[model samples]
Target: MKINIPETDQERIVIVGGGFGGLTLARKLAKSNYQIVLIDRNNFHQFQPLFYQVAMAGLEPSSILFPLRKTFHRYDNVYIRVAEVTGIKLAEKRLETSLGICNFDHLIIATGADTNFFGNQQIADKAIPMKSVSEALFLRNTILNDYEIALSTTDFDDRQGYIDIVIVGGGPTGVEVAGALAEMRKNVLPKDYPELDCSEIDIYLVQSSPQLLKGMSEAASEKALEFLTELGVKVILNNRVVSYDGEFVEMKDGSRIQSRKVIWAAGITGSLIPGLPEGSVTYGNRLKVNRYNEVEGVDNVYALGDIAYMEEEEYPQGHPQVAQVAIQQAKQLADNFKKRAAGKEMKEFSYRDLGSMATIGRRLAVVDLPNWKFQGTFAWFVWLFVHLFAILGSRNKLVVFINWVWNYLFYDQSLRLIIRTGAPWKKMDDVIDEGERG
Candidate 1:
């Protein structure tokens, strides 16, 4: 099938993935001379930084997502297609997606990254990774469902399996999740499940590295560790989770932790598209790009965000796969497009380090700005302000702020509800088959 985008006299720019990079680029160039086609698996743009908050039941998933069509309703040149890009026809300058084939004058790949299990099929089979809104919601459901099951179980060992959680990875995601779960364990669980001892619900954060938040400053990492420890999180450093089979988490050192849920926030690899030329990809499945974000050995095709590996003077390996890097690169590429339109020379992309921050829990956080490094209450507020400001919609900002204030005052998260639904991979036909079999 062929994609049904209207033919235009202007050049077409097809962007894959509605992530920070693609979304920013499309928004910046919506009024430009080029016809923009934005394709993604989901019809909405997800705020990944706040995904943990959704998983922890602190915020709703809809609060962090904005509709793509709504974003470009006024722009006549923009078209949004909800489909997965299967492959690229580099020779034809076309894209083969699940929906149809699309032709583009220029293409931008910003497909972002997926949870990396590091070639562990067993772990991949059982462990849950919070990479998207659906995954986050599934995690929330699994946790609440486990608690429901635990409330009815009289056996101690089985109850331990139901309640205990093992989070693998000490990065910002793992730290934030651990902190949020720790908060739930302390304040929410005791009141909700009065029949069971909430203290038995151990929250273990296993990090292969020596410190939490590895890329952040030493002071921030140490402070995060301290805050998590103070909140009764069992922070295990320098320990790798080798395998998990729905019951126990086996470590690299042959140690085992019996837990039903394993949150795999360990690592990420680029979401690579097939049919790319040989030697175009590098380590971690990222596309090798130049300073102009143009993919090597490919013309009129560029890469941005977590999937692009652009080596600069300071970052010899590549820029860090963060949202800021993606946004900055997108802005630069958008400007380059405008420059090309104006018959002006395009400029090279440069990254500005904005530093990093992670919140351990309420009133406990650490921030490392370029000029300032701090920990504690002020840092926590700063973290909240930055994230709140970054959310897409004004309604989302108000809802999240109210949720935070309510949680703070009452020590409760009202969103802890188990929403049962078909898994993303399960088709309607599969559900019908299962129902018929039953």
Candidate 2:
């Protein structure tokens, strides 16, 4: 297959993955004399930070995603393709994509990370990961379906399994999900399923580390722990989940949580395309890159976002795999491309620490900035504003803000409908197969 991209006089730039880095880089190079081609598994740019809300039924998935072709409607030189890059043929200056082979002058890889199960096959086969819109919807459907099953089932122990949830990893994702489910239990579940005993429906957040939000300051971590405790989330710290067999999760300390649903947000590894030299990959399967974001052992090829591992004096291993780093790297690369076009010296990339924040629940959050550290209702507002501002489109922002308003006033999330039709909850393998097909 030809891949269908037309030949152009301008130097072609092929970017894989339409996540934060690819999108920003494409937009920056829109007017430049480069024929930009962006490809991804999905034809949408998703606001991933707000995905927890989608999973928890506070917001819809469509509100957080923007169509890729629609995003480049104004750019004559930009072309968007909905296809996965299977592998890179660096020697031929080409990409092996699902559609066909695509040759490029300069190829930039922004393929983001995926959920890391840490070599646990049982967990990988069972645990539901929250990395994309589909995964988020799968989680939402799973949770809602579990409740429906619980309400109808007569077996006491089986019913409890349906309601109990164990969310692994105490990072922002785990904390946010823990808080969201806690909110649902406190405010929504009781009203929805009055017959079911909400007290027995336990929500546990298990973290291997001693503190929550490891990368953040001690104050912020303690504050998050406190907030989650206040929300009735059983915070299990300093323990690793040894195994999960779909029915129960066992910890290293010989304790077990009886749960059917397990959310895995523990860690992430680079979603690397095959065929790259093994030496180019470092810890976490991330592509080792120079300060210029150029992938090691490769020419005219660069990487960005969580996939690129560039070690600096400040960051000995690599920069933190966050959206901010991806965006900043994209901007820097864009500026470098422009500089090269103007026959100027291309500068190296450096990351600017803009701080981090995590929302526990309503009026509960923690924010740590270089100059300021705060927690509580104000921090929650700050978290909301920062995320709202980071959303792709103004219309999306409006929709999310309105959803927040409605949910806040009514203490309810309206997107609780489970329209999914598929195999039984016991057949998670079937569900995974179905998701892959979709």
Each model's lDDT comes to 0.93, 0.92
- Runs of candidate 2 with Cα error greater than 4 angstroms are 421-438
lDDT tens digits by residue: candidate 2, 108-205:
99999999999999999888999999989889988987898789888988998989999999999999999999999999999999989898889999
Model 1 steric clash pairs: none
lDDT for each residue of candidate 1 in 192-296, tens digit (9 for 90 to 100): 999989988899999987999999999999999999999999999998998898888999999999998899999999999998997899988999999999999
Per-candidate count of clashing residue pairs (backbone under 3 Å): 0, 0
Q: How big is the positional error of residue 118 in model 1, measured in Å on the Cα after superposition?
A: 0.6
Give each prediction's root-mean-square deviation over alpha carbons: 3.0, 2.4
Error of 1 at 356 (Å): 0.7
Against the true structure, candidate 2 reaches a TM-score of 0.96
The true-versus-predicted C-alpha distance at residue 223 of model 1, in Å, is: 0.7
